[model samples]
Target: MPHKNLKQTGFDEMNLSPDVFAVLQTVGYEIPTPIQTLTIPRMIECKDLLGQARTGTGKTAAFALPLLSRINLENKRPQVLVVTPTRELAIQVAQSFNDYGAKMKGLNVLAVYGGQSYSVQLNQLKRGAHVIVGTPGRLMDHMRRKTLCLADLTGLVLDEADEMLQMGFIDDVEWILSQIPQPTQIALFSATMPAPIQKIAGKYLKNPEKVIIRQESDVTNTIHQKFLMVKNINKSDALVRILEASFHDGVIVFTRTRNDTMTLTKILEEKGFKTEALNGEIAQAARERTVNRLKNGSIDILVATDVAARGLDVDRISHVINYDMPSKIDPYIHRIGRTGRAGRTGEAILFVQPKEKWMLKQIEKATLRKIEEIALPSNREINEKRMDDFKNKIYQTIGTEDLCVFTDLVESTAKEQDISISQVAAALAKMLQGNTPFLPETMAHKSAAKKKGTKAEIKAKSPVAPKQKQTPARLTPNKIAPTEKGMERYRIEVGHKHGLKPGDVVGAISNESGLESKFIGAINIDYDYSLVDLPFGMPKNIFNLLKMTWVKSQKMSISKYAC
Candidate 1:
């Protein structure tokens, strides 16, 4: 009934099984996280525990290690059942059990969730799993079908209990707990103790040991937080500019739902980025593969919903972008926690709209950090960055790669063409660039007022001459439609004739592709369809995908606009 000390402790001091301790060492876990340090020992002692900790505090291992240690591996009849709110968390918990119990000779762990096939789960259940990690709904189904029996169940853990409550699974959770024997050791972990969660705990838990670990806002101190004010329609366009401007090895873009994840992933891929989507709709096996791909550097960007990205740990992730902000503070914390891990400095960028400034203030208060407001990087800035990168690439190649063959060819070409060596080098550079533009035509213009207090303050302070306003020139036959410099114009089938508005087109493309609206250019509605300006170099696959995307009950039929 008493609380535990919040002192730092080592896993070795917790009196865990040697196999479990050895696996922990192998997994690079040295000292226990705060929650783990406080809760693991009590759990090992078979005490009913009620733990309070935020996500990303290593709560999974705190309960998992103790349960695995207590499991009678030989008698395998689902001795430990971990019920999570979402399929992602269930898979994550099962993976943790497998990892912590790796050296345990006959230990079997299986994750059961709604999206997966019942037959697959039944086969694993019949084969006899020592531990089962599952969502409440699927677990209830199996229990009703008599596919999952709890005759030998010894331990039950309800992870993210508040999340389950918010998801309206508290009744199902209480029912599940009722079915388990009273003697079954229960451990409930939640970020916050709402009335409902507490009521459930009071009824179900018997003299539960309490371990409260508050997540400090300073946990995100290592992350450089920045925000950009963008209109809802321009978010995807803004996102593209940010991605092009920033130097990141790996990035995770968090969305609000599964559909957002898919749409954004398609948009990024069309823009020629190596991206993937993670959501509840994806099968468990495919989810595993996608995460693995992210870790191994096959995919540089991942668009995901909060539920799908729960418990995702990939060390290589350098940036976390909140494309669609979370409604709650806890999820915001969890989303940003994906980066700035393993003692590395990371970046967290949030795209805010005029209406969402209140949420921004809430985040600042919750995190106790001042998120600097930043302007969207102009085309000139992106081009400068590209040039710097190109120069560095050549210098790096000169140091690391053998350029003897290429250098000789360049010299021979220069001599044969009677051109200077510098001209020959420039020619080679242009050839290497192919059709890619070396410089962006125009930058996204920033208002003078927004430039205050930023790095552009000096420029804002400087006086400038005013020019007369003039009508914009029309597009010539040889020219692409005039747009904000750096953006190219394309055509989609849905237009005024199809009862499409600019917002409708923006919403469709932004939601479907994850492109920010700011990056999207002018829309000239035509009789049959519309012509919209989009970023150039869209991948063929993405273009095809957009063609099939619907807008106001009509296929987009998107194509490049040729002058």
Candidate 2:
């Protein structure tokens, strides 16, 4: 099918069985992704298929559904073999098959990989498994020992083919493919089509139909990318500030090491964020529980290393924060790809140190987009946000909860103490606040003050005439000129005084308003406020939200520019 026509097809229209359609409905899958829409029909027709797609594109279901549909329950002797690069992926693929084939009786699926007990796999294989998902190395071992028989295998899949090649498992993959008997349909999926992966496809696949959904260096344009320059000592503080200043439903913070995951998790928890940690040190069961917690909204933040977070698919991940930048561009892409998935908009924030600016450039070059640099939120901003959140909580409780008992207690306490009821309530609130201060000291004050002084110097050197409109020539070197036609100029109450930069303004407005960065026009930062160009005819509600939004250390207070 043509790409455009395929994009219009839904999962139900892809010739899926009623049982599979029921399962898809139960799992709340309404539409098909690009890869799924094109690959599923070809796989269902028993044709060899090759797909090029990135992570988080719903590729697992694209292959799993067709494999499950082709399974024969009566003869369960490993009819399908799925080879992946990592154990986590193996387990995830096995779980997808199980979840999608929940109603299929006597359909057994097994995941075999290293670090797992051999006895468990042996017993499961002996009992009979309709499908096997495994890593290349372990699957090769099983095949050599005659524990896993490919004699009855009717289908084969090499998932993450490029990743397997990078891990030096291409030889093993080829050996395993050579072992599979004739007449078995093959499906190979990779994020990138390197020459090595292409060689494998040419050698093994028979008249394979190609489906390229996305390129590896490509990121969803819906994701707003931003970065912060922070010192190593101040990373924790900066992270807290960003979390407080931005609104998100579920967040994943990536760290470089396992120990960092635990450390950050503890710190975030102490700071009153609902957080969890996923690392290699944790048991598999605990990791599963942590992931489940994230999915169910029991926790809002997850701190994890790259290895531990592989094959993680959660639709609610609204933001991805790179606390420590990855060493390579592929991992960086994979990390942020966790969000901005399934056509939903998301945001990614990177914390870059002065020394790592080169690495930031590498990422930007690879992704083919500029990573907007944003200032760290000042202490005043964090305090105001916390106060607003606390007040909102109280208001929500009053509107949705029964407070008669609390009101009576307050009234009685007021009468007994010979004070007003309002005083009693104030005392109760103070007691509830405990020893924690409502506002903490501003940590970024020195930098903010220095920026303010610099802004004053610039203003004195080149002052704007009183009550005159600021033109493009009046903008500083750090500002972007308003070049788009029909752009409406709006002023926000945050600028050099608040340590605000042009990119900081762009990031905040784009993320909070769900406006694409392309639509966010030029930015002009001044001493105590900034001017930005945006598309005209914005909705009243969105304009109000933009007004109330917080940037560096103050509310945007957004308004149309008069001059």
> Each model's TM-score?
0.72, 0.72
TM-score computed on alpha carbons, candidate 1: 0.72
Per-residue alpha-carbon lDDT of model 1 for 397-515, expressed as tens digits? 99999889988998899899999999988887889877756666633223433545566776688787798899965332223347767777788876555567789888877755668
Error of 2 at 257 (Å): 2.3
Best by lDDT: 2
Off by over 4 Å in 1: 1-5, 231-233, 257-263, 280-286, 342-344, 391-432, 442-563
Q: Candidate 2's residue-wise lDDT over 1-563, tens digit each?
A: 23544446788777776677889999899978778888999999999998888887878999988888878899979999999887777887899999999888898999998766688899999999998999988899999999998888888999988878877899999999988999999999987788999999999999999988744324456688999988755898888889987778899999999878877887887778999888766545446667888999999999989878876778899999999989998788788988988778899999999999999999889787799999888777788888788889899999999999988888888899899987877777779888776667654555676767776687888857779676654434354564478789898987776668778888778766778998988788887778899998888867876776655435689999886
Over all chains combined, what TM-score does candidate 2 have?
0.72
